[model samples]
Target chain A: SQTIHQWPATLVQPVGSPLSLECTVEGTSNPNLYWYRQAAGRGLQLLFYSVGIGQISSEVPQNLSASRPQDRQFILSSKKLLLSDSGFYLCAWSPRAGATNEKLFFGSGTQLSVL
Target chain B: GESVGLHLPTLSVQEGDNSIINCAYSNSASDYFIWYKQESGKGPQFIIDIRSNMDKRQGQRVTVLLNKTVKHLSLQIAATQPGDSAVYFCAENIAQRGSNYKLTFGKGTLLTVNP
Candidate 1:
């Protein structure tokens, strides 16, 4: 079975501090990776998605950025965090089998509180 | 802008009863839809999905109905349990020209099951 691991399940960062959240998938190769953020009322908002290594497509423009440094490993980073960046961040992966109906598998998620 | 929205923000149901959550979408071009459940401080988990070709799909005690005519989708949970308390979200897949499709989510509806 495939499993995703996200580190620092909860974090408290001060404003303007650097942020780094990591997500890695095991038991799957060349999977489509994605990063999403969810606020109190807002739904799961797609922030970035990667098709392959070094290829990322951003859906929303904000203080965060995502990178796929290696296959099965995705990282969401920010040089300086903002108060608005606080939210529940999720990492997901889907099979890239040239099919249109791919289901996403999500990790436990990271809850960031920027103070 | 195209978006997916839920009819209700919250719902309360008694244990052992059936529960129905409704969603409405604006984009008629969306060909795929999904339902996700998220607990507090956790990432959304995939519950069930339906394509444009299918009207309904069932999994375990959960059923998803898609009505393309009204652009509405619904999720029904049979014999609802207390563990089923969570926020349910509906998502629509928007295909990008010459690129992988993106999944856009609705605001979500909170389901509370009372014992």
Candidate 2:
């Protein structure tokens, strides 16, 4: 089974501070990676998705960005934080092309609380 | 681009009782549908999924039913537990949408299992 890892189970950042959240997958190669944010009491909002290394797509333009540096590594970053950015950050991966990508497996997640 | 939605914003069921949550989609071409569970301050977890060809798919204590004719989907938990209390989201991916297989998620239903 594939496993996902995300850093800092929870984070508290002040407005305008730089932020970086990392996500990595083990036992899977070239998996599609996604970054999502769920506001308090809201549904998962797609932020970014990456299909391959050095490639990324933004679903919703905001203060956040995503990058895939390695085959199994995806990173979410922000030059400056916003109070509205406070929410639950999630990392998910699906099997890449021609693979048995049935469902998305998620990481434990990182709760970001911008103060 | 068609969208997916849920019938209810929230649902409450007693522990050990069966819980049912409903969702709706506008795209008839969607081939894959998935249900995700997200706990407080956590990321969405993969619960189960069903394809359009099958009416049902079962997993540990959970089942997913896809009513493609009516464009409706549901998740059934045989014996809902406190651990089942969370926001449930339905996502759809239609083959026609493109190779990226971008998923469109519903607003989601908050399922609260009462003890």
Candidate 3:
């Protein structure tokens, strides 16, 4: 079975501090990885997605960026976080078999509070 | 820009009763849909999915119905239980300008089960 891991579970950081969130998947290779953010009482907004290593597609223009260093390792990073960047961040993976990749498996999200 | 939306923001149902959640989508080009359940402080979990070729699909105790003509989607839970209490979201998948597929999610509907 495939599983995704994301961390840290919760974080409190200063407004100008750098941010790094890591996600990894086991039992699968060349999977599609995605990063999403959800605000309180709002829908998820897609941040980035990668189909393969060293390839990333950003959905929304923001201070955040994503990178897939390995086949199953993805990282979300920001040089300097802003107060508006606080939210619940989720990591998800899907099989790369064309249309069948519609179903996404998500990891327990990270709760980031920028103060 | 096209988006997905839910009919209601909250629903309360008695335990053992059936629960139905409705969603509306605006992008006709969307060919795939999925339903997700998110408990408080966790990521969205995949419940079920249906493609444009199928009107309905069933999983364990859940069912998803899609109506392309009316641009509506619904999720039905049988014999709702307390464990079923969560926020339900509907997502639609559309190709991003001939690139990889992207999902547009609806602001979730909060479902509370009363015992």
Number of the top lDDT candidate: 3
TM-score of chain A of 2: 0.95
Q: Which residue pairs collide in model 3, if any? A: none
Model 3 vs. true fold: TM: 0.95
After TM-score superposition, what is the CA distance of residue A67 in candidate 1 from its true location, in Å? 1.1
- Model 1 lDDT, residue A47, Cα: 92
What DockQ was computed for model 2?
0.58
Distance from true position, residue A21, model 1, in Å? 0.5
How many steric clashes between backbone atoms does each model show? 0, 0, 0
Once fitted onto the true fold, the runs of candidate 2 whose alpha carbons sit more than 4 angstroms away are A99-101, B96-99
Query: DockQ for each of the predicted structures, in order?
Result: 0.69, 0.58, 0.63
Give the winner by lDDT: 1 or 3.
3
Best by DockQ: 1
lDDT of 1 at B83: 99
TM-score of chain A of each: 0.96, 0.95, 0.96
Task: Please rank every candidate by DockQ, starting with the best.
Answer: 1, 3, 2
* Model 1's TM-score against the true structure: 0.96
